[model samples]
Target: MLNAIEMILICLVAQAALTDLALRKIPNVLILSGLLLALILHLLSGQPGAPLSQWLAGGCAGFFLFLPLYLLRGMAAGDVKLMAMVGAFVGPWQAVQIAALSAQLGGAMALWMWWRYSSKVSVGIPYGVAIALGTVGVVAWRHH
Candidate 1:
């Protein structure tokens, strides 16, 4: 069940990356799919439909966790939605870890891109790529 969740997460992230790369936006379908997949995974894992408290906490956590960045326009709406969906799946702590890992990898990629492109780091980073990669990383680490 977790494996399926992981696969869906990775695929959704990849879809986000691809769409963002090609059109500078992530499709609504991709985000919805991810959210739905997480909900299904949670239920399938024999957990309650994510207790209201958990959902509320996770949603708030995920939103606040990335709110400042988004407000600063450092990330897009899709990225934020994706994180919230992930929070629904794994709760606050794991959401934080995933965000951290994604940020770390995304930072590296941005730095490299900056170095290669006039040493200027813009508010925009191709973060969906990092998310896609980090989802796989998180899933692997958690399973192990």
Candidate 2:
């Protein structure tokens, strides 16, 4: 019983994850499109508690939450932007939860990669995968 927003979120994250895995980069066009779609959907839905302010706040929350990692060079700009796009779809609170879950998943992936590579890992992990999985988990859980 996924709504249009949920469906679109799934598609956006799936595409982002695949692109990041294949090219090690998430494209700006993808993020922009998601953001634009989110805005339109939110405006059209007229759902309570989903005002334009919430949308902007959610995007800001997601961006700021990941900004430190980007500044430290621990992650790419694409990851940050992807998170912001996700927040635009969800909201500030769910975005926070997704960020936490994504961080945990990304850390686990990093550890596994380090161990599997004998601590000589050269390439960055596709963190968009973690973000995608986390977002889906949170959204599904909320629906449940």
lDDT at residue 86 of model 1 (Cα atoms): 66
**TM-scores of all candidate predictions against the true structure:** 0.82, 0.95
lDDT of each: 0.72, 0.93
Best by lDDT: 2
* Candidate 1: tens digits of C-alpha lDDT, residues 1-144: 366666766777778888777786777787777666666666667666564544446655666777788898888887787677666656787778888898899899888877787655444676777766776788779877
Model 1 worst lDDT window (10 residues): 51-60
- Tens-digit lDDT string for candidate 2 (1-144): 899999999999999999999999999999999999998899888877675666788899999999999999999999999999999988899999999999999999998888889756597989999999999999899889
lDDT of 2 at 140: 91
